[model samples]
Structure formats: C-alpha cells, structure tokens
Target: MMHLIRLELKKGGFTSYLWGSLLAYAIIACFIMVLYFTGNNLGAEGFQNYEDALNAINTFVLATFIIYASVLLSKLIINEFKDKTIHLLFAYPINRKKLILAKLSIVFFWTFVNVVLANLLIDVLFITINQIFGYVSGTLTITLLVHHAIYVLLQAFGAAGMSLLSLVLGLRKKSAAFTVATSIFIVMIVCSSNGNFNLASIIAVPLSLAVLGILITYLSFRNIDRVDVD
Candidate 1:
C-alpha cells in the first residue's frame, strides 16, 4: 500500500500540487490581511476584529480548499479513468480495491494537511501582525488561540471529507465537469452556512461532513470493481 501510494505520488506530480498549495495559501493570507485592514471601508462590519476576521478567513479558505481538493481528486482519480490509465493500474498484481483506496487516501491526506497548515500559518501571521501593528481588534489569549487551532483543524477535516464526497459523485458519473460543478455547489452551501460564525456551526458542520464522507467512501470502495476503467 505504501509503495502504491508512493508510485501515485510520483506519477501524479505531487510536488507541483504542494507548490500550488503554498501559492494558494499565500494568496489567501494576503487577501485576508487586505480585508482586515480595509474592511470598514468595504462595508464589512465586524471584520476589523480578530474573531470576525478569523471567521471570515476560515470560511473563505475552507471553501477554496473544497474546490482545490475536488480538482486534485479529479486529476488523480477521474482523469485516470477518463484517459484509460486506470486500465494500466488494474493490470498490476494488486487488489483493485486497495489500489483505489490508496489513491483516495493520498487525496484525503494531502488535502487535510494542506488546509490545516494553511490555516495555522494564516492564524500565526494574523496574530503577529495584530500584535505588532494593532490593526485588528480583540486580544489573542492562549485559550482563544488554542480554540482557533482546534476549530481550524476540524474545518480542514471537514473540507477534505467534502472533497472526497464530491469525488465520489464525479467518479460515479465519470465526469470531471460534474465533479467540479458539484464541488462548487457544495462550497456555496457551506459558505452560506458558515457566514454566521457560531460555535455550534464549527462543531456541527465538520462532523456532518465527516460522516457523509465516510459513507461515500465506503460506497465508492464497494463499487470500485463496477466502475468502467476503460
């Protein structure tokens, strides 16, 4: 399994994706900082404060990750099938289910890690800037920092799960367009619900997404053999 995952990593150009993730994080962080500084002028009430700014950043970042993950899954999974490379994969002396699982695992792990790291980096930068420049409101106490860390990690998990769910939908239809479109729709819904920035949403949304991802993954695994790789 480890060998297969490594092979996929090489074949899938994981390094490029890593670099892309870093670039995306930089862009998001910059955008958040801009909004933080000019939020009042932009008519964004409550965005000048640390908590609200963090919430807004989290919501946008998670949504971006959802789309990003969906694109990765499409390239790694759906494109393999569409291009008939999956036929080559199945020719190996490995269990078909395990092969698919390995691919999905790569998608999930990288997506989760990318989102978590990005969120953490943004949090650190935001707090540091606030401490130095005092642009944003609210104090970043130890407890609040810890809570933000936990919440962001949870949101990362949720984003990864939702991406996988979108993958399952796209794979079922063997349509990259469908997968990307569904991902966009899902992000829209998630962003709408996330605008409130409530404690309950932080818990409820991620948990619900995780559960849905588990179900979809199980279903995808069970039906792997039925998928027409040719």
Candidate 2:
C-alpha cells in the first residue's frame, strides 16, 4: 500500500498541490493576523477572546481547505480516465481496489497535513500579532488550544470525506470539470441560503451528501473491476 501511494504521488504530482496549499495557508495566515491586529483595538477580549475568535477562524480555514481539496482530488482521480492512464495501471498486477485505496490514502494524508498546517499557522499568527502589538500579558492555556485543535480535526474529517466523494464522482463521470462545477454550484446554493434553512438543512444536507458520495465511490470501484480494459 505504501509503495502504491509512492507511485501515485510520482505519477500524479500531488506534492506540488500540497506545496500550493501550504503557500495558500501562509498567505491567509498573514492576512488574518493583519486583520486581527488592526481590528482588535480598545482591549476588548483580553486573552480570553481567543476562544471566541475560534469560531470565526474555523469558518475561514474550512472554506480555504475545501477549495484546495475539491480541486486537487478532482484532478488526481478524474484525470486518470481523461488522460487514459487507468489502462496503464491495469497493465500491472494491481487491481482497481488497491488503486482506489491509494488515492484515498493520499487524500487522507493531505487532509491531516492541512489540519496541522492551518492550526499551526493560526497559532503562530496569533502570537506574532500579540507580540508586535504588546498584547502578550495574558497567559495562553492548553484548554483554549485544545478547543481549536478539536475544531480543526472536525473540519478536516469533513473535508476528507468530501474530497474522496468528489474524486469518485469525477472519475465515474469521466469529467473532472463537470464534477468541480457542480460542487461549486451546490456550495453556492448552500451559502446563499439564510440561516432559516433549519437544522436538517445544515448538518443533514452536507452529511447526507457526503454519505451519498461514499456510496457512489463504492459502486464505482465495484463496477470498475468488472470493466473490460480492451
């Protein structure tokens, strides 16, 4: 499995995507630090508000990670068909299940990396801003840090599921572009809705969609094994 992932990385060039996401996280971290420093006048939260700031931080991080995951996953898996490389892989002893697992593992690994990078970036930015602006008197506690960490993990899990689902859909449809466009459209509709959309509209909708994606992926892989490469 590890060897399979290594090959996928070499052929798919996913490291470049990982680097690109790191660059994006850096840019966003800097922007957020500047905004926080500029806006945090009048000594409002006073070291206690980091917890309060967490929810806002989560929104930004989730949005940024989703865009990266969706696009990268689509290109990685979908392009296998569009580029006609699925046939190349089948020429080896590997089966479709192993190949799909490799792709899924890559997605999961990147998701973990994103969570770490994002949280570290946010914490570093917070400290830098505090030091530069002379707001370092308040003590940083582990409890506050743990809260942020949990939220980041939750968001990453959501993204992992979504990315896998997106890749499966794109591969099955044989159109990375279409899957990406439809995903953006669906996200936009969800975003445009007011908060009145109900509880089910929020959690149930996305959770259901993600669940559907997993099912589709299973079905796609099951069918792929039955496909005639000739």
Candidate 3:
C-alpha cells in the first residue's frame, strides 16, 4: 500500500502542481492586498462590513481551492487507467481495492494539506495588514471557526470523491479529457450557483459519484482478469 501510495502521489504530479497552486495563491493574495491598500477612490463601493468581506473572500478562496484539487491532483487517477498503467500496478501483490484506496488517500491528503496551508498563508497576510491598520482587534467566535473548519473538511472530501469518480468514468469510457472536463463543469456549475458544496452536498454528489466509479472500476478489474496484458 505504501508503494502504491508513493507511486500514485508521484504520478499525480504533486511537486509541480503544488508549486503552481501556491504561486496562484500568492498572486491572488498580492492582488487582494493591493486592493486593500490602495486608498484611491476608484468610484466603486466597498464591502459593507468586515465580516461580509471576510466571508466573501473565504467562500471564493475555498471554492477555487476545491476546484484546484479536482483538476490538478484528482485527474491523475483516471489518467493512469487511460495510459494503461493499471495493469502494472495491479499485477503485483497489492490488492485492487487497496490500490484504488491508496490513490484516493494520497489525493485527499494532498488536497487537505494544500488547502490548509494556502488558507493559513492568506490568514497571516490578512491579519498582518489588519494589524498594521489597527483592525485586528475583532474577536472570533468558536462556533464560527468550527463551522469554517467543517466546511473545509467537507469541501476536500467532495473534491476527492469527484476525482475518484472522474477516474472511474475515464477508465470505463477510455477518455481522460472527457472525464476531466465533465468534473470541472460540474464543480463550476455547483459553485457558480452559490451552492454550499458542503458536507451535505458532497455526501449527495460525491458519494453517488464514488458509487458509480467503484462500480465501473470493479467491472473493469474483473473483466481484466480474462484479458491478455501483452
């Protein structure tokens, strides 16, 4: 399982994607900071309250991050099948279910860590700027923080499930780009409509997605038993 996990992580291109996501996050942070610091009245209305602005930023960032996980990391699972590497992975002593779960685990863990780190960096920069302007005295409620944390967990799991579903669809249909495009479209539509995409929505969407993926994967794996890999 460890070997499979390592292989999956390597195949997912985490080293490059991680840097890319961080760079994107940094650019966004810089842009937001510029907007916050530039005192010029650009003839546009500003946020009504700090809380409103914070929530807006949080929601947008969270959604974008989830989409990132969906596209960059999760797509690799299906790519492996499209590239015909699954035979190599499954021919070893590792169980097929273990292999599938390993890929899912790596992608999920990577997504969670990346999101948390990105948010932490954003929070630090925002807090630092607020402190510079004597605006860092607001107290945070435990309930609010807990809610945000729960939302983060749900979003990550949802993206993981989406990726797994994408993999299954790709493998089953032998189309990597199609699966990726479909997953991205679904995520965009959900997020654009102001849907929470939280635990409840994830449970509804990704669980169904996972079930479909598992069914496809099982059928494919079982069918592979009768086919020649030469």
Candidate 4:
C-alpha cells in the first residue's frame, strides 16, 4: 500500500500540487496580515487578540482546504477516468479496492498535512509580524499556543474527511465540475453559518461531516469495480 501510494505521488504530479498549496498558503497569510492591519479602514471588527486572529484565520483556511482537496481529487482520481487512464490502473496486479484506497489515502494525507502545516506557519508569521508592528491585541502564551494547535489539528481532520466525501460525490458521477461545485457548496454552508467557527460548532460540524465522509467512502469503494469508465 505504501509503495502504491508513493507511485501515485510520483506519477500523479502531487509535488506540483503541494507547491501550489504552499503558494496559496503564503498568499492567505499575507492577506490575513493585511486584514489585521487595516481592520478599521475596512470597517471590520478587528481581532481582539492572538486567539481571535488565529481562530478567524483557521476557520477561513479550513473552508478553503475543501476547495484544494477537490482540485486534488479531480487531478488524482477523476482525471484518470476522464482521460481513460483508469483502464490501465484497473489492469494493474493490485486489487481494485486497494488501488482506490491508496488513492484516497493520498488525498486525505495530503489535505490533512497541508492544513496543519499551513496554519502553523500562518500563526507563527502573524505573531512575528505582531511583535514588530503591534497590530494584533493579544499576547502569545504557551497555553494559547497549545489550544490553537489542538484546534487546528481537529479542523484539519475535518477538512480531510470533507474532502473525501466531496471526491466520492464527484467520482460517482465522473464530473469534475460536480465535485468542485459540491466543495463550494460545503464552503458556503460552513462560512455562512454564524456558529461554524466557534468551539462547539467546530467540534460538532467536523465530526458530523467526518462520519458522513467515512460512510460515503465505504459505499464508493465497495462499488469501485462497478464504476463505469465509459
């Protein structure tokens, strides 16, 4: 399974996706910094402290990661079918279930790692900038750092699970547009809700979505052989 995943990474151009994600992260970090500094000018409620800023940034990124995950699914899974490359994959000596699982594992792992690392980098950069410009209001403490870390990790898992669900939906219909549209819908629903970023909603929403993602993944994989590549 590990070998198969590595092969997929190498052959699938996942490195390019990783680089793109990092670039996106840098852009997001810079945008958040600009927002922090110009909150009053923009007539937005400025972050009350480091915790508030972290939470706001984490929430936005968690939603954005769904879009990233969808793009990865399109490139890694859906494109194989669209391009008629899945026939070659199906011809491999590997079991169909294992092959599909390996692909999903890559998507999940990549999405989760990107979310966690990117958020961590953003937090560090925001803090460093805060130290120099004093734009942010809160002081960083060990306790706060640990709390934010836990929050970011939990959200990352949730984002990964949501990505899987989106992939399954898109792959079932073999439509990249459908897959990405679903991701956009999810982001809209999540961002539009007033409680989505709060602790209770964060824990509850992701857990619910993660459970749904698992069920959908199981159903999708169970019928892998039946997928119509035509």
Candidate 5:
C-alpha cells in the first residue's frame, strides 16, 4: 500500500501543490495582519481579538485545503473517468479497490498533514509577530497555546475527512467543475461565520460531517470491481 501510494505521488507531480499551499499560507498571514492593523474598517466581526484571529486563520486554512483536496480529486479520479483513462488503469494487474484507495489515501493524508503543519507554523509566526508589534490587546500564555494546539489538530482531522465528502457529489457526474464547485459549497456551509458564530465552532457539525465523509469514502470503493470504466 505504501509502495503504491509512493508511486502515485511520484507520478502525480504534486510539488506544485506544495508550492501553491505555501502561497496560500502567505495570503492568509497577510490577511490576518491586515485585519489587526487596519482598525475595523474591513469588517472584523468574527476576528475581534488576537486570540480569535487563530480561529479565523484556521478556518481560512481549513476552507482553503478542503477545496484543495477537491481539485486534486478532480484530477486524480474525475478527469480520468471523463477521459476514459481509468479504463487503462483498470487494465493494470492490480486490485481495483486498492488503486482507488491509494489515490484517496494520498489526498486525505496530504490535506491532513498540510493543514496541521500550516496551522502550527502560522500560529507560531503570528505569535512572534504579535510580540514584536503588540497589535491586539491580549496576552498569550502557555496554557492557551496548548489548548489551541489541540483544537487545531482536531480541526485538521475534521477538515481532512470532510474533504472527501466532495467525492459524493463529484463522482456522480464525473465533472471536474462540479467537483470543485461542490467543495466550495461545502466550505461555505461548514466554515461560514457571522459575528463569531461559526458553524464549525459547534463541534458537532464538522464531527458529523467528518463521519459522513468516511462513509462516503467507504461507499466509493466498496464495489470497486463492479464499477464500469466504460
């Protein structure tokens, strides 16, 4: 399984995705800082303080990468189905279920790992910058940082899993555009916020959605060999 995953990653040429993720991080970092320094002109309803900024940043990253996962899924699966290249893959001397699982595992774990790592680096970077500038009127302590770390990890897991939910909509039409659009719609509902009331902050929403995603992933490959390439 690990070998197959490695082969897929090698052929997927995902180095560019990593570069794109970095660019996203830069944009998010700049966004929060602008909020801090801009003095309430740009609508900081949910981002009232420095601490709330963490949640806002995590939400942005989560939304960004869930959609990221969708685009990759489009390329790795939906596009192949559309172009009839999946028939070639099905011709290989491999278990169809394993091939599908390998592709999915890459997207899931990649989204998971990137979200966690990006939040960690950005959180620390934000703290360091906050120390230098003292923009928001709050003091950071070790206890709060520990708690935030746990929250971020849980959020990352949920985002990673819930990302697969896009497959439910994407595979139905074998349309890449539909896949990506569905992801955006999912992000809007889960991450939407008004005056600090975020759907994801409810805990049950993302947790339940994550569970649903796991079910969707299972259903996706449960009858793999029975699925027709034509």
Candidate 6:
C-alpha cells in the first residue's frame, strides 16, 4: 500500500497540490481575520470566547478541505476513468481494490492532516491578531487548549471519513463537476450554521456521516477487482 501510494505521489506530481493547499490556508486565514473583525464591528457574530473562535475556525477549515478532497478525487480517480487512463492501471498485475484504496487513502490523509495543521496555524494567527486589536473576549487557558486539541482530533477524523462519501456520486457520474458539487453539498449538510442551529454541533451527525462514508468505501472495494473500468 505504501509503495502504491508513493508511486501515485511520484507519478501524480502531487507537489502542485501541496502548493495549492498552502495557498488555500493563506486565503482561509485572511477570510477568518476579515470576518471576525467585521463581525466585531456590530458585535453580532464575533466570537465571545476561545471555544467559540476555535469552533468556528475548525468548521471553516474542515469545510474548505472537504471540498478540496473532491478535487483530489476528481484528479486521481474520476479523470482517469473519464480519459480511459485507468484501463492501463487495471491492466497491471496489481489488485484493483488496493490501487483505488491507495488513491482514496491519499485523499483521506491529506484532508485529515491539513485540517489539523490549518487549525493550529490559524488559531495562533487569530489569537495574536486579537491580542493586538482586543476585539474578541476571553483568554485561552490550558483547559480550553486541551479541549481544542481533542475537538480537532475528532473533527479531523470525521472530516476525513466523510470526504470519501463525495466519491460515491462522482464515481457514478464519472464527472469532475459532479464530484466537487457533491462535496459542496456534503459540506452544507455538516458544516453550515444558522444563528445557533448548527448541524455540526450535534455529535451524531458527523459520526453517522463518517460511518456511512466508510461503508461506501468498503462496498466499492468489494467488486473493484472484477469491475471493468468502463
């Protein structure tokens, strides 16, 4: 599996995607600053405590990367199927399930790691900026920091698993547009918030989505060896 993933990374030229992720991080940070500050202007949606800020940032980061995961799926899997390149891979003596799993693993781990890292960097940047401007209320204690770490871990794992579900529709349609669009819809279901009604805040929501995603991946792998790449 590791060898297959390394080959995918080398042949796939994932360096460009890494650069794109960096750019996404910078853009997310800028938006966080702008929104939080502007929100403080009217004292409306601005964060009232450290937990509130972390929660908002974590959700935003996960949502953005979940959409980004679809792009990876589009490039790695759907595009190959669409262009008939996947036939060459399936022709090899490799197990089709493992090959596809390698690709999906790339998407899963990429989204997971980036969400955790983005939160760390963005959290520090926002807190520093807030310290200078004194817009947000409350301070970050050891208790809150510990809780944030735990929260980020669960959210990262959940986000990683749920991202696989995006491939379900994309695989059926075999369209990159459909893949990305499905991810956007998933983000809406899990991440979007209205006033105090946040679906993501409910523990069961993300967990159920994650479990469903895993089931989807497992089911797809079952027939992958016999399934032709038509």
Q: Pick the candidate with the highest lDDT.
A: 6
The candidate 1 region of ten consecutive residues with least summed lDDT is 193-202
Clashing pairs in 5: none
* TM-score versus the correct structure, for each prediction: 0.90, 0.77, 0.69, 0.91, 0.94, 0.95
lDDT of 5 by residue, 1-230 (tens): 88889988898898998898899888888877777666445554424566687887888889889999999999888898889898998999989889888999999898999889888888888778778777656777788788888888888888888988888788889899999999999999989888777888776787789889989889877988986765
Off by over 4 Å in 2: 41-48, 131-140, 186-212
The sequence of per-residue lDDT tens digits that candidate 2 reaches over residues 1-230 is 89998987898776688688878788777766655665556543333355544544554565566556667677666777788877888778887788877887787668657856786778677766666775445556898788667656655565556555556656667787876765565456533334323222344554565566667777767766777743
Give the per-residue lDDT digits (tens) of candidate 3, residues 51-168.
Answer: 4434445544545554565465336556566677777876887766677667667766765676566656775677667767743245556676677666556555554555455555
- The residue-by-residue lDDT of candidate 4 on 26-104, one tens digit each, is 8889889878878845777777788778887887687778888898889878888778888998987778888888888
Which scores greater on TM-score, model 3 or model 6?
A: 6
Better of 4 and 5 by TM-score: 5
Candidates 3 and 4, the one with greater TM-score? 4
Candidate 6: deviation at residue 66, Å? 0.4
Per-residue error (Å), model 3, residue 44: 2.9
- Better-scoring candidate (lDDT), 1 or 3: 1
Per-candidate local distance difference test = 0.79, 0.64, 0.58, 0.81, 0.84, 0.88
Q: Single out the weakest 10-residue window by summed lDDT for candidate 6.
A: 195-204
Alpha carbon deviation, residue 61, candidate 1 (Å): 1.7
Quality of model 3 by C-alpha lDDT = 0.58
Off by over 4 Å in 6: 42-44
Candidates ranked by lDDT: 6, 5, 4, 1, 2, 3
Q: Tens digits of per-residue lDDT for model 6 on 120-181?
A: 99999998998898888886799999988988888888888898898888988889999999
- For residues 137-221, could you state the per-residue lDDT of candidate 1 as single tens digits? 6766788778888888888778878788788788778888988998898877767654455432556776688679868788767
Between candidates 2 and 5, which one is better according to lDDT?
5
Over the full model, what C-alpha lDDT does candidate 4 score relative to the true structure?
0.81
